[model samples]
Target: MTTLPDHYEIVRERNGYGSADGAVGPVPAAERRRFVAVDDEGVFDRADRRRTLVATGVGMTGPPHLGTVGQFLTAVALQEAGLDVQFVLADLEPYHGGAPLDRVRRLAERYRTFALDLGFDPDRGRLRTQEGAREVMHTAQLLAPYYDPDRWTEDAGDDSGDTDPPPTEWERAVREAYEAGEDDRRSGTAAVARPGPSSEAADIHSAVLHGADFLHPLYAGDYERLVLQFGVDEHHLVGMARRFRDAAAVEGGVAGLYTRMIPGFDGTPKMAKSIPGAGVSLATSADEIRERIAGDPGGDPARSPVFQAMCLASRYDAERLGRLERACEAGDETWDRARSEYAEFVVGLAERWRATEE
Candidate 1:
């Protein structure tokens, strides 16, 4: 019989001691919220250990953005707070359709270097590409059958004898739009703006038209397989994470795996890379960051893009940054002043952090 790690004890105390049933009466909102709050007043108690942190995300395309920086800060905070941290770079999410395979390879190399530049270890708490973790993919495949077809569809195609045509009007419209785009010279307004027949669009169509076919099945299956492979149920996994935290407490406690979903500059929703003007990238440089910050119209300083970047960057204490954010939102200050202040502050913070680490 395999015994749980000594570290597993720590994981249980912080995350495992909870009810599986999604109920709230026994657990107050304040208690539940503590699981995520990381500020000094909330739960960054410098003495509790039982947190284990892991971050997983797709990184096979596009440049690393401020969102990636936010995740890095999250991991850094955990490490600073004394938790064991693991950062997983998910690169297996298909980056190419058919051609340009070499481009994908180059992008991967660039991103790996970028990760290193950002201070993540390439070995210890370093990167783990999706390709490097095939078990995760396999697990996803095994769990496909458990998902409801109405809620999920697979890409089994005609092999499964499910040859039904696009069922919804939206899907039909998408198909028509795709077919109409074959001729580049099509001139109508609809033709001009129609979604192109790119593989990206095709993948979207497959998901919308088929549902749960490509990834959902894998997720549902692999989750169970992972539980067994690790010799722990869903509840146990939670326990392990918490136990890891508890064990780390003796050396200044540990930071839990909590992430804040910062909203976009427009205050509409969470900043998304795909949404036009939804976010700024980490590699956006000081000039771009300043420009975006100076241009935002949100009244609450807390909602200013500059402030958002600072928060995401974790460069300043929340209280001070909150004040700056508010000042920007109130229109009491000019963009130039705010931009100058933010840029200096960010540069100083980065220097201090690097020096301390060294």
Candidate 2:
């Protein structure tokens, strides 16, 4: 599991990003707003708001979980803060996991509606797909050669079978999906067998598309500077794009804004759609969400799953969040009232989302 301390160290020191204290730029207005770190902070700090585009995306492997909801909210917040934004529905990604094309298309439409309902203004920005996006796909091919095969093939053990480091959350999720058995991707399925040498190469190639998801906007959308938002676990993709842009001699500068990874209830490093019952989602029942939040607030207020959900999933302002945090620490009645309100907020949002499908 990737601890917060170690993750912070990698972003701040190893990646040469500005520290959280130094997060000076156009950012979302949430409580405890920290960029964690931003690559090329100066370029981001000075980028023109009108000409800059902030991009974020989610995979269509599953429905809208709280983690995914948080990402959507971040995009809305960025747009409301005055910078143009683009939200990509990565329908093509689940296809790589063997999801049927028709099912992927349905999920992509659902995701688009959800983002609009969550306050992402189509007038100010764009909500696009990774599949059938002609220019973006072309950009991926153009950038493919620069993806650096060494990024993955290196440190891979020789035939002697020396083990590499532990698998990341993504790798673990993929492995578990394949281990369970074949099924449709609505339940988050994977390839039938474990990834072999050739399959591993395919995985690396998919990353080039991931790079294009971020870079294509700068080239095609006519944006001068681009800011990418993702969870801290996805920080490596920033370096991947930087290398590709430099190698390919692509114009335009890029920077990143990252959110903290919310730990899963299943004791996994982070909440994920592939992990059943890992955390609350739009599909979870209202009674269950209320019970879950009230039953266990977790040990630390800052690290508490309940509080984290409230911070990310709910539309609570910074002042209210601060007040609830203080009350939670004191174990007062205010916290109790606030907890019930938070549960209702999530429940109502879930109900509205479910209604869209019906």
Candidate 3:
């Protein structure tokens, strides 16, 4: 496995993002580096902090996991750095994958309460569901013409110059369907609604909604810029939005900050909600969470989900985490000790928030 730093460097180069070496107020370069990459540091440096909105979200198909919690905390970090933040609960995005609206809404409510427990202040910013946001829905419709189905299909073909192929329309449809099925499995429901018949239309529709998800604040809230934070795999979504922003000649620009992913315990590339038992979640019992974290014999800190959780999700400072990493790499007992502590941290968080009546 690639070391964490080396992995992020490769991703930054591949996506044409600048080196993650800048500070947001007292946030510092080392702290920003935790996110891995950004579309342009200059965009961030130039923006008026009060007028810029830092946006991030997760699909409302399930409970919060380590990866998603990390994202929410990252948003809070930016808010602490003196910028406005918007944490979207993408209730509508998963409807394309066949997630029932009622079930999705319930998950969104739970997620909202959980985010508050994790320290997101609505007084400083916003946390909203896409389905309830009529302005965003209207903006999505306005931007619908900017998406081109033919171009995306061509880009996914064999003749394309890109080494990494974009997901074909059918592949995206299948992915959504699978995610919807995961929702069903997690909720213990046998049957549920699915997307519309045309896979191509569903794919394009999703792209449009995504574009609006990024731009609606700029359009409706009158924010001057958007700094989108997402996992590296979703870089294409940022690219698509950038293209739309340019084609439509929108007033403000959209910049990106990409973060590293934790490999799933089940051996998938990233810890994903669509896969059962892939990573630790706040909804499970304390002993069960510890068993899941400790039972896995993670060989190296770079490859360990526990260490990645500490880096991404926990409030561990950069210095402490760096020391732990170096010590673990030198083949000491640091990793064993650190992993036990991380397990307890996660268990405590779960007990505190998941037990809430809300």
The numbered model that scores best in TM-score is: 3
Compute the lDDT of residue 242 as modeled in candidate 3: 63
User: Would you list the clashing residue pairs of candidate 2?
Assistant: none
Model 3 lDDT, full chain set: 0.70
Which candidate order results from sorting by lDDT in descending order? 3, 2, 1
Output the TM-score of candidate 2: 0.82
Predictions: Cα RMSD each? 14.1, 5.4, 5.0
Per-residue C-alpha lDDT of model 3 across residues 1-358, encoded as one tens digit per residue? 3345565665566567776666344455445646767776766667466777788888755667788878878877777777788888877767766667677777778888888888898999889888787888889898777766543432333222255544544235436546755678667873333344236566677667777888887767578888888876565666666666776666776887778777667444456666555678777888989888776555676666777777788777788888767756664577667778888988987876665544
lDDT of each: 0.40, 0.68, 0.70
Per-candidate clashes come to 31, 0, 0
Query: Candidate 3: which pairs clash?
Result: none
Best by lDDT: 3
lDDT of 2 by residue, 182-215 (tens): 3433344531222222355556656677778888
Model 3: lowest-lDDT 10 consecutive positions: 152-161
The TM-score of candidate 1 is 0.50
